[model samples]
Target: MATTPAPATKPLHLVYTVTNIQHKVRMLDGTKVSYSSWVKLFQLHAKGYKVMSHTDGTQSPAKTDTEYEAWAEIDAIVLQWIYGTLSDDLLVRVLVTESTAYEAWSRIKAIFLNNKGSRVAALEHEFNNLTLKSMSSLEAYCQKLKELGSQLNDVDCPVNDQQLVLQLVRGLPAEYDIITSYINQILPTWETACSMLELEHHR
Candidate 1:
């Protein structure tokens, strides 16, 4: 039979696109107000907090309404650009906390550049950053498990001694125990992220 050449495979791709949708609120008012006035209005509408500007309107005075609007527009543009690329839950969660959101944004940029664009890069970045110390401990234990397994494999033992290998594996519960512990550790962080995102439970 004649053989046909197969087409080349492409790397998995995921693209996030920002949509021009309704409900896009302007972060600032169109009125040309002083910095203090602008900030006061913004807080009143968005956060229900009353804010007062203490600056003397010099040396980096509060943002002008236009300047403030421009920055807000930039934020919307950036966020819109990244919107659909993230799971809705993740988006919502990060939006809840400025710290978490900024951390996520920084990590996302680093990961996209570092990995040449992969959603896995984003996930790995979040995972590694969020679970550093625990992950280090888990990795060390996993390495030990692999070393012990290798030692057992290299020994000159009869096939019947497979039971001995099983015994050795069974006796060392550290690896399995650690895996469960790691999972437990991850669950809470994930839950926190999800909660911040405002995703409701299925149950």
Candidate 2:
């Protein structure tokens, strides 16, 4: 029988609070963390106001006083969240005298989003250079690979199944050659490959 593996440690969660509204999720450091944080942050604010895809009236009808008021409230909350979550250094550098939540959000996005290309390059470099050392635990190796793949996906540069499977096999030590050969023949999905590797580790 295959023994169940212990679960991995979870990352710290990031929380946002203002007035009656409270939101929390795993920590976000702009670049290292998953881009899902970006989506989640927006969604949290979207609950109170329309933040995503908001127009500036040049293309559509101008907002009414009531609409503007509601927007302003949500923007303030979102701004608070951004200010609260960012590191002291980043907060100091990115902070601007913007009056609206949209402006603040756009400024932060401009700072981070513009670096996607460089971030993608760095991730790919790490992926290519990754290798399972003889002393390393298989679980740790697998976790690292999955993390890099996930971060890449978050930034709009997804690693396909075949590439992930291939990379894993290629990076294994020589002792894993026989199993790697078998894996190549089967061409299993990434999750299945991970399970098989874990099972092999147990054996």
Candidate 3:
């Protein structure tokens, strides 16, 4: 007698659906946001959907392997996600008929992350945008800003302690306006600024 087949409700292997990835990620306009941020969100999306290997270069199967065709199908879906999320100008530059998801991903990443200059620019942009939100503790905000400044310092673009202090002041919540004004008048060191912010945070 013939055996019964697997349940029809189960999705078959090799079946993939469009993620409409752009809605989950912004279109990379090469200026609106840093590429690292864009790519991080995209990678997180891929990881959640269990398709990260397609874009990360660690899971290519041999053509003769039984899983190869299914892998290719998923890879094609990943490639589509990459293409769909890119701006038209970026799409034209990195899009190639024969590219795998990994190839396209790397090309786009390199466009913004290739040089020391680019890295510094990106880090500074992120630092400049940092803010103390209600959801984050005051300590964390100060620490993150310091870390970004340190990263800039490490790249030979040293953020003087005064500049770091000013940046931290800029990100302060309005409740700290009085102390921030005092801090600015003093033009204290970053360490001094953090201490002031922390004391204000507790009040």
Candidate 2 segments whose C-alpha is farther than 4 A from its true place = 1-24, 30-32, 44-67, 84-93, 97-99, 115-117, 134-136
What TM-score, computed on C-alpha atoms, does each candidate reach? Answer: 0.21, 0.67, 0.59
- RMSD list, candidates in order: 24.2, 14.8, 8.2
Candidate 3 C-alpha lDDT tens digits along 43-107: 88888788888777796989999989878888888888889888898899998879899999889
- Candidate 1 TM-score to native: 0.21
Evaluate model 3: give its TM-score: 0.59
Candidate 3 stretches greater than 4 Å from native: 1-15, 118-180, 183-203
Q: Candidate 2: which pairs clash?
A: none
Evaluated at residue 13, the lDDT of candidate 2 is 20
lDDT of 2: 0.68
Among all candidates shown, the one with the greatest lDDT: 3
Residue 110 error, candidate 1, Å = 10
Give the CA lDDT, 0 to 100, for residue 121 in model 2.
Answer: 94
What digit string (tens of lDDT, one per residue) describes model 2 on residues 79-104? 67666666666678668876565565
Ten-residue stretch with the least lDDT total in model 3: 10-19
Candidates' C-alpha lDDT: 0.33, 0.68, 0.79
TM-score of 2: 0.67
